[model samples]
Target chain A: MRIVLIFALLFAPPLNTKLGAQQKPAPLEEVKVVATTVLLGQLVQTIGGDAVDVDVLVKAGHDPHRVLPKASMLLRLKNADALIMMGLDYEHAFLPALLEKSRNKNLQDGGNGYENVGKRIAALEVPKSLDRSQGADLHPRGNPHYDLDPENVRIMAMAVREMLQKVDPGRSAQYQLRWTEWDQAAKQEIAIWKAYLKPIAGRNLIAYHNSWPYFAAAFQFKIAGFVEPKPGLRPSPRHLAELEKTMQQADVKVLLMESWVARSEASGLVKRSGCKAIIAPLLGASKQNRSYLTSMQALIEMVGVAHGLPTIQEFKRDAKEEQ
Target chain B: MMAPALLAQQDGMSQGAERRFDPAWNPAIGVALDAFGMMVGGGDGNNEANDSITLRSMELSLSSRIDPLAWAYTSIEFGRHEGAYEVELAEAAIWADQLPHSFSLRTGRYLADFGKWNTVHMHDRPHPFAQGVRQEFIGGSLAMDGVELHHWLGIGDLPVRWSVGVGANFAGHGHSLLAAESDEDLSLGHAHGANFATTSAGDFGLPGFAWTGRVSAQHDVGDNGYFQWGASAFLTAAGLSQEHDAGATTELFELGQNTLAIDLTWHRLAATDSSSDTIGTEFFWNQRDAVDETFDRVERLQAVGLWGFYLHEFNAHIGAGVEGAWWEHADKDDGGHWLSGAEAGRQVAIFAAWKPTEVQRLRLILAMNQPDPAAAADSILAVQWSATIGSHSHSLDW
Candidate 1:
């Protein structure tokens, strides 16, 4: 009877171990993705969700134009399972160097894990000619700010969804599920943005640079002229005078500027035109705007406020009270 | 030893869409015109920068990718020779990437990745004058014909690079920037080592041509600051004279050389690339075997030099800076022959620059030069204009 008890105890250990293995499965390994910009990081995180870990190459609040792959950025890239980029040579003059220096062939152009979201969208404002003298900064590739158009973002989401599934097939269903939910959220937020900005519909806005064509097209706003005579050149006094004339004619009340652009150049225009200037950061400017949809909502809310309309926050509070 | 390949920094003048190099130029061609007019010694005592407004070092560079794995670059320079223009090959090398273990290989006649200053061409210096320490110890620049292996230590967060090089014709120094005709400095050539080559009877010379090793790295100091540091060592031997015998060649008088250089540079770049402030310092120590013309025998002489500078760019078009360079004989000043002329000297300068665009710059410099402590200081003014008309890529020495 004692030997029988000992045999049962020893065999019972193996029985419990087998039951533990069968009952509690291990979690799938998360794919590591290195995304170039804060906006792209937000997009990757949305689609990857819990199945992937996203490392942002260009940290938030830093100058987006100043993306230098220092050691830290490079190391993260080297270890990444996939890399997401905003193509169209969007100051990606450093991309070739980064890939070569990282010595990670998997992230190169032809590699399996390389993803360029630019390919997913049809670009706007593609120059007919590559004329260097025509303007201050004419991108040879069409406007890369297509993501500003929420529709283009949906396209980018599809591409990201496919990329994550390809890199981490075991979590394909999880990524697809997150993508589906993200699509719904984006659609709802975009509708709110359109309604919030409806008061200023068809109003021509003055922008410091050529960053807002996609955004203007997506919303109901009209863009008359820029503070800069050309796309990237400083606004000459003559150009500013001309732009002011256009602003008066178009009744443009908002002057939208990028955060990296110097404000001193546009300060005179602000006073002369008496238009409210809105400085839109690249992305992830405020704590509340931590994600892509939130960042876009924040930008839309600012424009609404500038036009003397209620912000999205007020709109949400009113809806809650109604309910 | 390794020039940090600075990522494409949007030159504020370039606006947002400007590509630093014109990729449209199929085989990327670059040209630079460097001309400066300075004191020509208009003051109290002898100092450097005696050239009287000369257009020197017009470099024409050509580069193309050799294949998927390699690229070749060649630079030819045209300068005044015997009161006429002559052309010389500055650098011609092929760099191969895609090697195993983050290794890159470069082979040809190129600047030996020696000190930070030695690797930078004269056209790229902020000021027109070469720093005194590096200029006196190793001449304006040290070019080598051989192979260099570079390894990017993908260690942790910082990008650390180590490079080792060995080759012949680790020729003497830069000729255009040199003061005058001197044996220590030789003309650039594939067989330049032959200038100092002799028979094997003088086994004093090392069989290997020249050897160099360097380790360099950089890190971000703050939100808008970058710091780069480098340490380098170089060794080479050359024969001073060869005795001719009746039938065979005789023993040679060989001078063994060793050089060590350390440098640190910190840059406070504006949020955009519109403006920046730079503060930098470089230290050099050189020990060499040379024929002491006084005693007519080989003597080991050591020298040390230090240079520091602070430069601030007010905006895109304007900048001002102050630089001071000092060097002296570390060994007893017994008046050696080969290097005695440049013994102990110091130069200080304050200047302002007008960079109208990315490709055009004009600078006005006011400098005080004292070759020796006992000598009178020479005050001089310089006006320099530099222009680049094509795509130029400099693996930068930031």
Candidate 2:
């Protein structure tokens, strides 16, 4: 009786172990991807979902154009399976150095694991001929600030989805499902944004830099002129005097500038021109602008409030009450 | 209703259309020009032909990806020589994509991967003048016609990169192998006698081949700080040969030479503004072996140099820095006659630069040098203006 009991106990343990192993599903390893900017990182996260682990090189509130790649960032890139960048020379200042030092062949230009979201968008402000004499801050391919427009964000999301499917063929179905869900959400939000921003349409505005041409084009806002004399060139006294005349003639009442740009120049212009200045940071640059949807909503609300139109929040509340 | 119609129009225009790939495939071309005016005075109160304004250098550079596997770059420099414009090929190299097992190759005439300062061009250097050690040992821009193999070792989580190279005409005129006249040598003419006159393969009395290697490591110290350190070595069987018996008989003496250098750099970005601080230092030890004419025995001559600097960026458009350097030669029974008069010396320099934009810069430099043990110290004040046109890509400094 004792020998039979011992044999039963030993057999039972092995049987239980095999049963547990067979019942559990194998876990999928997430693909690692590195993005050059915060907005691109957020888009990659939204589209990639659980299929990818994303790392952003340029942190929030920092200028993407002036980011200096660190050694730790390169280390993260070394283990990444893919790299996504906002091409068109937007990251031209620092991305090239990081890519060369990473020594990761898969993430370099022409590599199979590389994707440029800017290439997917229809560019704006493209020059007929590019020369340094025109300006120091010229982007040869065109304005790379397309992400400021929600429509362009949708296009970028599609590019990210395609890249993920190509990199992880086995998980294409899961990526497609998530991409569809995100597309639906983005479309709904974009409709709301267009309605909320309608009040500010056809308004004359002034920008501190050449960073908002795509946004202006999308919203039907007529940009009077930039505060700077030219792209990346600081304004001289004479140029500033001429800009003041143009601003007054256009009846511009609001100045838009990024958070990183010095407010002194914008404030001075505001004082002289009797216009209000609004800090319109890029997406993911602040806690209020965390996600893609929230960032777009915030930008619309800021512009609407600046022009004395109803905020998106007020509109949504009113609509809900009417419904 | 109007908003929806407007958005619909935007949507119609935003359709994804494939851009012509061939039209976008263009090489990046850049031109950089530097000009400076200077006034120099000696403490001994003898100053003539020391005040002048001249164009320092003009560099034309072009780079492009040749294919999926390689990229090519070339830079040509034009400078004034004897009141005439002279052109020289500064750098022309092709680098390959890293292959299996993390290895890559670069070939052609290129600046050797030595210390941190040797790879940077004159216009880009923080200081207006080259380091005393760099001028005395490696010369300005230690370029060599060679093939370099670089490998990145994935050992632990630390970042370590290394390279090994071998080249021809390592001791030639254009390539400053063991010792050759540099652009600084031509410009200053104070350290001309300190360098060995073996400027070609025939002068070395041996096959003019040299080998160089470097190992560099980088570490991140805190959120916005970084540290980097590296060591480099160069060796060649080429050295200076002299005639015996006062030009009566020439001896076929084979000579050997080598150089060793170590460098350290620390950089920190300001937490509140666009300011940053960088501290860097490099030390060089150069040695040469030759048969002494009088002793009839092999003798080794050595020179040691140390240079250090601290640079600060006040803003996007303004920067300032200070640098100090010291060099010494081993005194032998021959009273160190092999070294130039000003080779063993020390100097201190301070500079400030104002850049209105990314492409234009104006800088002011104040320098004081104490050359030759017997000569009095001298001071120089220089104003430099620089401009660049076209695309510019920053290289991997590590």
Candidate 3:
């Protein structure tokens, strides 16, 4: 009798009904999208509006490369209508395991609702060889921080709108209209930022990681050096000494650092190089600046003001008056 | 910059055929090499090799995504048992995630998802020693040749996962280290072949599968800290214990066993990479029908064990820890009441490790062991070198 009961439990409805998988997923009232980051989620929110419910997988101040797959993350992915991700191995460490374990099929690669936003945008620092003789190389495909560039943001936003249309086509017109408006406003903001950032456009700045290349390319600034000798590796003392010498010899007087990166990580370099450090958000990190557009504006103004330049708000006001 | 995007997108599409067959998309090959050297001072002659070197324990593992619906993992282990070495298919499992209600089904031959310790491989253990109670009760670790279903749910910020497994190993058979050894006459986790005088009765075999259940919960104390607690239960036929008078069997009894365990772990990561402190504790209580052949008594034997460890990683390259274990022999028969000189014994070890990289580790351990409570403690010094090359993956162990 006990053996019979054990076999009965093994083949219970919840465990066996979907052995091969549900032929058709139950209809969702709203497209439940799981975005890999807050920045991507904000894009889905802006373009998707009320037609979609977006769940951010990686939380604020968390590193995507070091994500520890947890149960809460799995629960969210189990029923997701779609998945938005920054490809190029941004979610490499954790996404594969979680996605395979998740019940949601739409989020899988090649699925209609699966979107890799980074692929549509430009990539930088594509490695010529996959060599580990130097140190830990987290970014093997290319730099995944293309969202740092506003033009790339446009490409990613376009992707979010298209993915939503594919998953929840009833709201296609609503998404397309919002994306058009978003692109226009983003253009205006980028114009204002460029005008104010023109002074430092050709100047060189030291960065903490390889995260700022897209931002540098967009704004026409040159990255003089980095605190970390290699990507994902801590800055050694000897490397810091060499970086300081480069900063002094090259007359690079500004250092750009991301918030959430321990300032202590770059403190030694900051002291030796005598460069003014400007800490900026890594997009949609705070509740107040969760929107990509607002975070970009805040990031530009913080860097400009720190370098003794006037705020871009004045140029934004001027542009509004001209419009 | 815009040119790179356009050129890369075009190049990417052209390389689509090549990408499909890329080695990166296929199963990852991983190999682990483990070697240990031990020097013992004194013991009750329990271990055959008091001063010896073992280089046989090695593992090769493969893992990759099968498709959008599943992921798979398998491991081949080469290990030692009683001065002899053999290769064992330690684990082979396919995880199907596209089930209903957030339930994941894992089917294959794999570690029993019971408490924490059973799933840990010998190479992954904190110290190089036989687990006391677990060795006596289950084996080195428990392996199940069957299916396990797992479900994850959350209560606010706390996350919990539960797993239930049914397998033949649960039915007192298989080569899982914790399954002890393939079968009754073959291997026991730490075989006490001398205790049971009667051979297993051919007609006494039970046909039911073994059952295993586990519930684990996790709480994030802070950004850098994690806490986990869990409980597990295992029910199975524990083989036979018979009463024999002057080498003639008088009564035969089937040993049915019920085992319960609880575990706790706390890990705190320092800001620096690979620098952290972790403490874990596990306790087990097991009950089984047994015949104290010495006393000619048939009764339910109750046994217990406690094991704990504290590991501190000083940097990316170095770590140290202390592990201590205490267990009461399953036969019970304590001093004065039953047939016993002593019922409980303890082992403690202090170890230090150097990890050149994530895949490489070399460690040295100094241990004081009381194989028998009535015997004086023995001290042993050991050194181990373990390394994993190629693809390596594991849970965060939070």
Q: How does each model score on lDDT? A: 0.71, 0.74, 0.72
Model 2 residue A248 CA deviation in Å: 2.7
Order of models, best DockQ first: 2, 1, 3
Clashing residue pair totals per candidate (backbone < 3 A): 1, 2, 5
- Give me the runs in candidate 2 sitting further than 4 Å from their true place: A1-28, A69-75, A96-112, A282-286, B1-28, B80-85, B171-194, B200-208, B221-225, B244-247, B269-273, B290-298, B330-344
TM-score of model 1 (CA atoms): 0.81
Per-candidate TM equals 0.81, 0.83, 0.76
lDDT (tens digit, per residue) of candidate 2 on A1-323: 99999999877677667887655343348889898777778878987887789988876656665666676777888888889988988988778777876777788777778998878778888899987667777887999989878888888888888888877766777778888999899999988888787866898988988888888888889998988778877677687777789888988878887766656666777899888887765566568787888877887787888778887888889878989
lDDT of 1 at B231: 91
Tens-place lDDT per residue, model 3, A1-323, is 99999999888777556764734444347888999987888889899887788888776656565455665566677668899999988888788778766656677788878999877866898878776555564577788888888888889889998998888766777888999999899887787778889877787888987789999999998898988787656677888889898888878877887654557768777786677887766556467476777778888887777677766767667767989
* Alpha-carbon interface RMSD for all candidates, in angstroms: 3.7, 2.5, 4.4
How far residue B50's Cα lies from its native spot in candidate 3, in Å, is 6.4
The TM-scores that each candidate's chain B achieves against the reference are 0.78, 0.82, 0.80
Give the alpha carbon lDDT tens digit for every residue of A74-168 in model 1.
66777889998878766453465676678788898878789998877778888888753555355778988787788888888888888888787
> Which scores higher on TM-score, 1 or 3?
1
